[model samples]
Target: MEEALPIRKIIHVDMDAFYASVEQLDNPELRGKAIAVGGSSKRGVVAAASYEARKFGVRSAMSSVLAKKMCPHLIFVKSNFDRYRELSQRIRNIFFEYTDLVEPLSLDEAYLDVTENKKGNPSATLIAQEIRQKIKEKTSLNASAGISTNKFIAKVASDINKPNGQKTVPPEAVLGFLENLEIKKFYGVGKVTKEKMYRHGIFTGKDLKAKPLEYLQEHFGKSGSYYYHVVRGIHNSAVKPTRTRKSLAAERTFSENISSEVYMLERLETIAEEVERRLTKNNVAGKTITLKIKYSDFTLQTRSKTLPFYISSKSLMLDAVKDLLFQEKMKNSVRLLGISLSNLNNEKKEQQPEPEESIDVQLKFDF
Candidate 1:
């Protein structure tokens, strides 16, 4: 008889209404009211919404104006990223206590591989509960958790009982759980894919599994293979520990759209300076500089230029963006201007001292 694979235990944790909830927690007056966290201006986008606000059809990334029209009395609170990051670090510290195999997806969510934990605890479900309870105690915030044998199912399972709850899918029950899941609930199946699946009569996981592999691959291309295995409970993606910062960027949406070349040049110089500052603060330099422009109509475009050597100085970065901006005439009035530095090479990682709070840790376990 052949030996079986070791079943890995995974947990996905997501904070409820992170930014909006934090606002409410910090300010007692904001509680029990429909509130959103974002700029309140006409062009401002919603970053998050409280549960009460969500009931009013308000959502993140929607224009502030639309959100207001949806909820006439929606309270808008400006974002406090510094405060959010502090809480995020605290949450991450809690995760590190359980296992070093913690992968943070954002300031409010993470995936943890607790199969072999520092506490020597065997039940991932119990660990998740402990973590959620601790988060509530330490930060006065509620978090939901999903426990499963792999990251894919854990990510989906986390949503079963959202906003201060958890769900678990054991290895033996994984197939049964996936079978009844709706196609819309699948991670990669977005609005477009959901519509396509519905048109093809693939409304549920069972419907997806019934389709032939060749038919799926032909219809969905590379993603078809992904769906074919994931719906059948075959995802084996590991919980990666190391997350490299891929790029350093800074951008701003203007209060008003403008088209003048002279005005744009001035804005690019300012944005480039901010990018340079972030690159310097992060102790990274890059060979590629990308210029992003968002037109008034919301259409976006980017142009990148690669230098022969890495550059992080404000002047060098400004020169590159200036050229990219002036290289083409205005297509439409520009509403947003941004600069990003990519192909990052961190020289300080080896040649110089690390940042005061910098930590690079990895652990290995018996497989």
Candidate 2:
């Protein structure tokens, strides 16, 4: 067996209800209300929901019909991709100050390897606090972060205290943390896998770890091996910052709206192949894949999922894309379909954005 790498400090930063928060940030009227970013058409799906909306069961990829049913006064706002993109770039700039090994999962989340950062900060936890502080000052937006010895734990930790909070799992606490983590909370274990694991009586990481490797492989196929290793907190994937954070994205705006899920899959297969070619041409691999859809009314939605390991193969990318497609049902005619990948190993950090000036920030991050 290959030996594990020495423990390194990693931080996973994710903005809290990013798009909805952005809507609230720019428009003060919507703060602390049930709001989502997407068209209000009867055949539209929500792209993102505010924390307040989430309390009422509103969620991304959910139909507006259901959202309004859940929250009778639900408010829908149009998405502004250009503004979101600009804000995302600003967030990445803050990350670059700490380390060049910043792997952007999307416009709102990234994994940062801060073992040896530019700030010369000794404590990764402190660095996470500072980054979150800077983000608030620069964008007036809240962020949550996870800090730990590896990417998997760090990513999960960030979610423990969400919406303007931070959580850190020390190296000594990694195993204990994993043992207590619910099986459903494990990264990459979607609904189907969760059900399968439940059938196997694996309700927590502890139970998952109890299964023999061969038994898992027999029952879960190749992914069975994947589950066996994760329960042990053995994920060794690095925080990869590619030469460019701009991923290999292929998009098509249909001449006419497409509402059929079957037709959408056909287009996705073609787009995934194109993304695969782009990754191959760049000589890189991506562990995270995203699917973007635009409704006939011009409102857009994006859904993404990350794998534990990097992939450049066309079929593999297609597999993930297809998984994303079925995760939600279409509520409207789709006018555009796009697929992209990030987490490349060669991404570099050369240009950094300027943070907002004339702002005073207090260092009051909780433990």
Candidate 3:
């Protein structure tokens, strides 16, 4: 008989309304109030919203005007990246006390692998609790966590309890846990994919598992294979310690729409400078330059050019962006403009795959 593979213990930690929470934490009067972190201008979008604001239908990525309409009493605060970064680093430091295998998804969320950790602890559930407690103690902020055998399930489970809580799915329970979960709760199934799954009578994990690999591939293409394996609790992606920076971008939404190409070029010059600064800070150069444009009516368009050689200078990038900008006439007045660089020299050419393991034995733990 083949020996059963060891089940990996992974945890997904996500801070609750991280940006808004930090604002509230710093200003005592803002606590328990509906607050959003971003500009409150006519063209402003919400970067984050507190739970109180969320109750009123205010959400991140929502327009500030709509958010105010949803909650008239909502307060808007500017983003302070320096403070956010400092706090994020402090929280990350706490994670290293237990495990070095950490993958940060953003300023507010990360995945950790602790199968053989520095703590020498056996229960991932307990580890999650301890980490959350430490975060609360150190940052004076609430966090939620999910403990499971893989990153995907852990990420999904972390949302079950919001603000300050955690959930654990042991190896034996993974299959059943996934089987009963709502299709929308699957970590990677976004709005469009959820609607597509719904149309195919796939509203739950069980429904997804019933479809054959061939049928899924026909429907979902490359992503179909991912769905097939993950629903069976077979995600093999590890918590990578270092993640590659795929692209760098800078963009601005104008207070008023501008139709002049001269004005557009001027704005593009500033955006290119910001991109160049970021590239210099990261010590990287890219061959691909993409210009993103959002019209007054909210329709979006992108133009891209890839050079034979990498370039990081603002002047060179501006020249390339100029070509893309004038390559097509403006369909409408522009409300937003952005420039991004990709195909970086710093990106790894190949990635070493994590060893594959299969679980056969039931995990015995009190979660």
Candidate 4:
């Protein structure tokens, strides 16, 4: 039998109703009310709903018109992204106090690996508690944390306690914990995937572990390997820092609308070259390319393609941009053109056989 690796202490921290919480913290009167931060018009959607609003079935992304119908007294507040972003930075500083292995997941959630922490604290649970305390003290907001031997369990644990609490799963209890977990509760297992699992007779972790790897791979494609290992309680993923952006793009605003297809393609080529030069200066290859164009009518559209691999070559990017420009119709006079590339790589993950899904846990936070 293979020896078990030493236990790795992982913590997953997620702010409670992040945007809504920030609003509540900033305006004390908003606390304990059914407040939503988003558009108030029928066409607008709710960006975040306070816990009080949730009681009326109002939720994030729900149309504001419907949200108001759900709760006639629902309060609509405008989004203040600038303030929220500033607060997110303050919370990030709290994570740095323990370990440098902090991975941000948007402006709200993050995964922190404290297996070998700078705080010299051996217990991941204690670290999570301390972090929560610090965040409350610093931001005047509550956050829930989960601590466990691996990222999968830690993430689930954090959700279990919720809103303003912490939970931990010991290494030995992993199997039991998973066996009791619902299929929908599994990270990355969405409604569509859950329905598929039900058809496959996979209702829980134990049910999942019973399947052969080959069977899962045949069905789930790229995500199959993940289900195989996570059901068995194995995860080897590490946190990845948010690195600096490597490319900048500039676009020309045409004075008059030009409807010529060939002209648009040529313009795209020039923009792609500018983006390519910037990538070269920074020594980066972006697998994804985004094409931006604005029409004379002020309507805009952006189309993108991600190569199987990243490249910094100007010719290659220009060629790809040309293909995209030709694929779509030139509905109006081209008023502007732009191009950008992201998904940079110093080392490519796709080059290797995918490390198990659970093993790519930290990378999941980037989503």
Every model's TM-score = 0.82, 0.71, 0.90, 0.73
For model 4, name the residue pairs that clash: none
Summarize candidate 2's per-residue lDDT along 1-367 as a digit string, tens digits. 8553345788999999999999999999999899999977766789999999999999898888889999999999999999999999999999998899999988999999888889888789999999999999999999999998768889889999997999998756666788899999888898889999999999999988899989998999978766777666666667768525557789876767899999998888888888888888888888889999999877889999989999888889888888888888887899999998986776665332122210111112122
Itemize residue pairs with steric clashes in candidate 3: none
Q: Show the colliding residue pairs in model 1.
A: none
Supply the TM-score for candidate 1.
0.82
> lDDT at 2 for candidate 3?
75
- For model 3, residues 1-367, the per-residue Cα lDDT tens digits are 9776556889999999999999999999999999999999988899999999999999999999999999999999999999999999999999999999999999999999999889998888989999999999999999999999889989999999987999988878888999999999998999999999999999999999999989999999978888988888878777889988999999988888999999999999999999999999999999999999999989999999999999999999999999999998999999999999999998876432222543435466334
**Positional deviation of 188 in candidate 4, in angstroms?**
0.9
lDDT of 1 by residue, 232-274 (tens): 7767667878666778998889998989978988887888888
Candidate 4 residue-wise lDDT, 232-269, digit = tens = 67766766676456445657666566799778777777
After superposition, the stretches of candidate 2 with alpha carbons farther than 4 Å from their true spots are 1-5, 243-367
Ranking of all predicted structures according to TM-score, beginning with the best and ending with the worst: 3, 1, 4, 2
Steric clash count of candidate 3 = 0
Lowest summed lDDT window (length 10), candidate 2? 356-365
Whole-model lDDT values for every prediction: 0.87, 0.84, 0.92, 0.81
Candidate 2 has an lDDT of 0.84
